[model samples]
Target: MRLAAALISCVLCVTGTVGGAWLSRPASVDYGSLLSKASDIYAVTDERGDATRLYVVNNASNAAISRIPGAAAELPWKVNVTYSLDGPNVEANEISGASGLVGIYIDVKPQSSAANHTIPVVTFTVPTQVTGDISADNTASVATQGSDIVVAAAGNVSSGLKFSCYMDAKK
Candidate 1:
């Protein structure tokens, strides 16, 4: 009887220690940031100019969070998005061609009952132009299916510009 009681107590101690360690792990998101609230959609724009507009959609809820007006002052080039097992992060390339690249970071707000803060699920860069011409118009779109991120943008000197991208999950 005495041996059995001692073994039981030892097992309980080990189980409690393991459970506490798992619960004490750090969260992936920063609770104090703007992304602490829920966000259904988002957009990206250039603060310098209004030349390009990048639109993002959270298809599950169908919300739009970010936007860029036109090609007058803003010129967006490339937008890259990545979603991993850890979380999601979006990067916007604000510069075009060989000039350089500017990165924009996005954070999603957490759910009301979530244990941690909001997480970042996308990352990309915006494209830039060489001539800095404000005459052309451009539009871009981004979407995610599972772990992949897609972006598409199109533009024309005569009519205008339009681009769209969509990424599907891997098998």
Candidate 2:
């Protein structure tokens, strides 16, 4: 009985130690490799020129997530997403009768070759049907200020909802 009890304890100890290490394993994302895949990757902006559509990498494998609508050919650079109530999710957040306004700050750029340049703040009412990673359809500005291009479009409501600036490698 003593030997059996000791054996069980030893087995449990070994199992837990190995299991803990396995559970805590972390991995690195190689964004460079994904970017080099010869696909048309773009970072879109909103009207007035705010970068509402900041990049949202998949937490699963650091993969870039994009939802192309059926009419994507008409506007290839646009980002469209489908909200899922029963969609595949790694997890979900629960709300307990919460009511208030909220805001999100997104850091984005005009072109993929361009570095991250602007910060756009998006605020919306709570309990709204906004979901699926990032901002959606609206208008933005990638125009000019005086001579130089005006990259930051602040206080633009349409710009607050959609992305205008984009990258097109389809040439």
**Each prediction's TM-score against the native?**
0.15, 0.16
Give the root-mean-square deviation of each candidate in angstroms: 25.0, 25.0
Best prediction by TM-score: 2
User: Which residue runs does candidate 1 get wrong by more than 4 Å?
Assistant: 1-138, 157-171
Model 2, residue pairs in steric clash: 45-163, 45-164, 45-165, 46-140, 47-139, 47-140, 47-141, 48-141, 49-141
Per residue, candidate 2 scores C-alpha lDDT tens digits across 45-102 of 6657766654533343445557676564231112232222222211113212222222
Question: Residue 112 CA error for candidate 2 (Å)?
Answer: 35
What overall lDDT goes with each candidate model? Answer: 0.27, 0.28
Clashes of each: 58, 9
What is the lDDT for 80 in model 1?
Answer: 30
For the record, the alpha-carbon RMSD of candidate 1 to the native fold, in angstroms, is 25.0
Window of ten residues with lowest summed lDDT in model 2: 1-10
- For candidate 2, the per-residue lDDT at 33 reads 68
